[model samples]
Target: MTTGNIKPTKEKKSRKSKPVVNEKSPLLPTKHEEDAAGFDEFNGASFSGAVFNLSTTIVGAGIMALPATMKVLGLIPGIALIIFTAFLTDASIELLLRFSRSSKSVSYGGLMGDTFGKYGRMLLQICVLVNNVGVLIVYMIIIGDVLSGTTSSGIHHPGVLEGWFGVHWWNGRTSILLITTLAVFAPLASLKRIDSLKFTSALSVALAVVFLVITVGITVFKLFSGTVLMPRLFPDVHDLASFFKLFTVVPVLVTAYICHYNVHSIDNELEDNTQIKAVVRTSLTLCSSVYVMTSLFGFLLFGDGTLDDVLSNFDSNLGIPFGSMLNDAVRISYAAHLMLVFPIVFYPLRLNLDGLLFPSARPLTSDNARFALLSTSLIGLIFLGANFIPSIWDAFQFTGATAAVCIGFIFPAAVTLRLVNLISNLICHQLSFCHLKESRFQFSLK
Candidate 1:
């Protein structure tokens, strides 16, 4: 029986043996299948590890600014905005995951590529680069502030480093940042996968909790002692400028919850990828509680005097129990937390850059030399940025308004909507084809 003379019934049997697209859920792929394709590395992270990593990413320098946001928007609105931003952030991440599953994309850049082609990928990469770099620079600035105190109006508040080294040139912001970047951040950033940073992420979260505890303790003590200043529930809105500037808090709050960039990266690390939504929800809820406590207590402690950086509100002159000791502890602990956070944010940045610069090269995670060079170059840029940028608030505002908004809000929504349209069209086409086949059969019978 030559193949050319095979019976039509046998040919039909062969066709029927092939896999049918409609038989499988379009968005859900089996774990073994994705693993065999090398799209994800299994057993990389546990549920707690993923949650810790994501919580650390979400609750960085942004929380320090939330008290200041309360000063601008007043207590009620600020708290409301924080909760609202968390909700929106959660929604956006859900969209990303939905689209990512449908497309089988392993990274944000890949998702964009799948949805909008090369230009879309490039756009997302650019946004990640800008947002992450700006954030890292802000981290450096806060670290510098804590380690080498800021001088305002000829009075010097001693930084932890400055206090230890007595105003020496080597103890300056530039020197401290350089030493820390080389000694600390570079090594952490060099880790290949985000899951490896789980231990450090846990430590960072602990330190953040410590900072929150100290703030809450101080606020409660001050309240009992009749020393705490109460913040207004609503802003006074004395002028048009002040009223309009109320909108500015939106971007800051948005930036506070800007962990959308790393959602897929963390998802890729999970041992059970099906747990991503649970991980996201848990992380966001934890971060929201932390933000609320930090902002509420921070605002209560400082009231309208809250600086753009809440850590700045702590001074040795506060005369609370262990006032000076608490100051150093809060600053050092939070700065250290930021140190751990730098690597988490950098993970996605490096991933996106690799996709842009070496699209055809092997995965950077698997390429030692390329990963080293990329990490070094990015840290160097951030190093220079930290040295020059005088204010983190400015950096946060610019990046938050542009890149953060696009990545956190616009891209996910657009991609998910596009996927919906594609699925709708496919269903419509399938139904039309089936109707036509039935019509032809009916006509033949007649």
Candidate 2:
């Protein structure tokens, strides 16, 4: 009956469609939309996967040195600093996530670029490169130590391979590292997305847990058997120089929690982006607990005599059941864990390098040859550094004091302050504008 009136309804629908078309008529998506697509490839990671990956990143070779840090800072201060670093780390990452979401920056470099311009981006990239390289070198060094053992003062302590097979060409540090790089690490590093390595990350975390459990178990066994050494609750300060030296441990603690750079990347991969904060909190909490337990028990097992590398402490024969077997298990398992961790750390390093060198190019993950070459070169350099470097502690100190501090603490704080300033300025400008408009209206009425 009123088919003519139906024409008005159709016209009304057409008019409504015009505004919808205009609303979305932009030539490009918004920054957040772009970020969503940019992050689409690796968005398969679950909350648990992000937690495990992040936990693995936080609890790396640093844990082995923590007991030594505890030795320097003593039990109370050392434990305090560990928790303190975790808190700062959580806060800093929350800053990172907040800024990341606001700016729609997916990577650390991208965030720096948005905040501090191109040079800021370069600085972040440099820091990440130095820090990740140092980490990879430490991983290789530990792997070499585990597989081929080390010699000091004309005494030879056999590594797992040497202990198992005696002195052989194949069990040599160089040989073992080469074999490992070629056989295991290179292949893993070739993976395109961080989410793809979640299984390995989980395995790495499990191995670290195994290492921690072994340390705690050994310490407990020795304690109940009345063989455990009493660790100092405070450092023995002799001279002012010695007292000041305690501050050195702070850098190591800072470095231990230097997962800030990867937080954005992990956040981007979350199945639900809103869960980033929860994932970060869970990861930092888990890593902090693991670090405290490992360091406390390791120190209890070794006391002031604890070596910078806790694994070295195990070199001396422990008179327990399967002592030698347990020793090898901890060493080998941790080394393997470091091997798995190498790729995760390397992931961001490679991405940063790609962004720096080939900013306009397609994603490295999409460019097979470039990714392979980049991985090979970086890993090769790391292998050389590992061979040449005498101590992971020294590497940790340099990277921690410089790059780790900058990336983990300084940058996040600076960015947050910048954002706050911008927001304050905007609010003030809005208020000023309103006041001016009100004054103008009053004058006009008068």
Candidate 3:
């Protein structure tokens, strides 16, 4: 045969496999460069461990204000909203995971970048900074309230330290918060990874349980002793302004369940990454149970006397055995639990702040100077905010209405709306997954 008669073969180009993964595959993993194997020393976190961390994130500072919301919405509406928020949170997180998997995006900021642009991601970082800072400030304020006491409505609710040792310069609000900042918060926040706080998260959850058990005990004792009466099951609305006050309770409820910011971080660390859904369901179920019990019984115990910080209501004499002791126990245990929860919140705050300031820089844990500067600067700012802020309700409302709402609901909805056509079939096929669209729709109408 002549050489010219042989057809030229088109060579198959050898292509490299990109790191991006398809959702249909089993792993469904979208990891950051720093998270790749041999990059970080730590391995992935266990399912139980991830649940504890996420639960701590959800159950922080917000729980204190839930009873106040009950005062506004009443028990029936309050409990209903709480459960609804849990289901909604589960739905939102599911949407987040689905979008993340489709785009092969790892972090929340990264997901935003994929959906909107760099500016969108930057906006998310700013919102996170505002929300988490507001949250941590509330934590510090509650700690100050519990350990050093808060003065509200012409009544002085004495802190545990004051009751135990009387007020000293060292035991004053400023001193107690400073000492806690240096001793408890500083050490924990300085840690590098979310998974590292697993033990502390477990301890924090247990301490919350301690508070719940004590509240239930006191409520039951008073109920059985015929010393207590059920509070209003539905909110009382008399006038136009009174009706609007019901809307004010929305932020408190939103803040109570605003754990979306930490979802990606927790999912990234899970050893069995697909179990992220289960971890979320488990965490929300546990947290919603805790929130309901706390709201119902805390309101029952206090009734019309419930203060913005329910812990403040605990300062008064309960008609029970060793009432002061029980009061002290509840406040002290909760304060300590907040100390543990501080780092879980602080971890994401620091990460986002660093992302905002140093987008092109290396990983946060890799740079000692950047990590220290951000950590101290944030703690100092929050400490100042706690001291200056007059009310926890004000902080919760401000953060929840603005940053928390955006972080929790708006951005995710925007992301989904931007690309709804792409994955319409994927979402429509799974009836269980339809909750996100339904929940978000209900949320907007609300």
Candidate 4:
């Protein structure tokens, strides 16, 4: 992840991407890459920057739900599912990248529009709208949950501010979330580029690591002290219903990896688009590692006591010295992490929403007023939803999860399977053309 020494050169921009295999080879710089245009904006993002943005996309509220998933599926199956999902996610993204390059589409929506029709593009857009906005709203709610405690069973849990400074008008949920939106989310979201959030994305990933580190530390301490016993490594199944219930984690697993929408954007902005596949691999590797460790240690620490949202589980006494302080640290750090993640998610949401509504309009970046209108509208909608309609979060997550399945797994697989022969023929034609062009150049030199 260290990016200090490995500098990417951008001053000598190339009109065409380097061949994928070799200069003598005719496999890549496929029709799409040959026609790919460089952005005239700021220099493209360094490799690490792209990795951070994409990793942020993949690791959202879903990470908090992973520990709970492990509780249901057990460590063995749980870890297996995580790894398997990561692989599937990798393949799905690969499909999107491959088909996108072959089809000459720049965005996910465009790819869909190319592969299918306008209706297909519209479907992907709607799904992204639901998924990203729901995720952003839930992020706001989680922040509120951390900074201003939530109530359940007629008991009110204390938030960091409430516990420390006592409840005040300023520390109320709406007040705190509003301040957070203005102070953190607004400026980051306002940036015109996804790579602009690179540093914040890196920090966000670091905060996630902070949470993971603390969780592992607490678990290790408890293990050595012989206070917390080893948890079950398999699901405790008895009834037929119990056996069927294990499938419920599928949604969580799928949602954990639904980042296909933003793949093209990141790839679009990379200094070298060819490195996008490597970026995907690195991001997935880093995120999946965090996910596996978090699931394992978090399940070990809380065991049966783990809640659907494990952040809530942090409110209780954790049977260690300075446990209360560590609890606050974990919650607050992750809250801040989500704050950073806001913009990375918001970027694609804005892009897709714009493309959905204004398909024929100029590029969003070139149209300042259009960009502002979309950004403000989306943020306002999310802010109001976080404060007013929090009850629908469950429903939103369900529908969003469904849409995410389509964006991540279903659509990519369909594009690949349905158009295999077409792509093969396209590749053959491109290859023959490349071979002929190479021969003419050689003959001319002779």
- Which pairs of residues collide in candidate 3? none
* All candidates: TM-score: 0.88, 0.90, 0.87, 0.85
What C-alpha lDDT do the candidate models reach, one value each? 0.80, 0.80, 0.84, 0.80
Error in Å for residue 399 of model 3: 0.3
Ranking by lDDT: 3, 1, 4, 2
Model 4 segments more than 4 A misplaced? 1-42, 153-155, 388-397, 421-446
lDDT of 2: 0.80
- For model 4, what is the alpha-carbon lDDT of residue 369? 91
Clashing pairs in 4: none
How many clashes does the backbone of model 1 have? 0
lDDT of 3 by residue, 247-266 (tens): 98888888888888788777
Best by lDDT: 3
The best candidate by TM-score is 2
Count of residue pairs whose backbone atoms collide, per candidate:
0, 0, 0, 0
Question: Which 10-residue window of candidate 2 scores lowest in summed lDDT?
Answer: 19-28
lDDT of 2 by residue, 1-446 (tens): 55755643321112112111110111111233333343222224577998988988888889888999988988998999899889989888888878876886666666777777778877888888998999889888888877898764466667888878889999999999999999988999988667778999999999999999998899899999999867899888999999899878877898898887777666655666667788888988899999999989999998877777788667678889999989988898898899899888988888777766775565555677887788888989998998899877888888888999998999999888988898999999999999999999999999
lDDT tens digits by residue: candidate 4, 334-397: 9999999999888778877876777655567677899889998999999998886543236335
RMSD, model 2, all Cα superposed?
A: 7.0
lDDT for position 54 in model 3: 94
Candidate 1 per-residue lDDT, tens place, 1-446, comes to 46987656521212123221110111111222422243432334688998999999998889888898888988898898889888999999988888776776656666777788778878888988999899989999888888888754455556887766687989888999999999999889877667789999999999999999988998898899998766899987999999998877776788889988777667665666778899999999999999999989999988977777777667566668788888888888999999999898887787777767876555555677888898889999999999988777788889999999999999998998888899999999999999999999999999
Of the pair 2 and 3, which is ahead by lDDT? 3
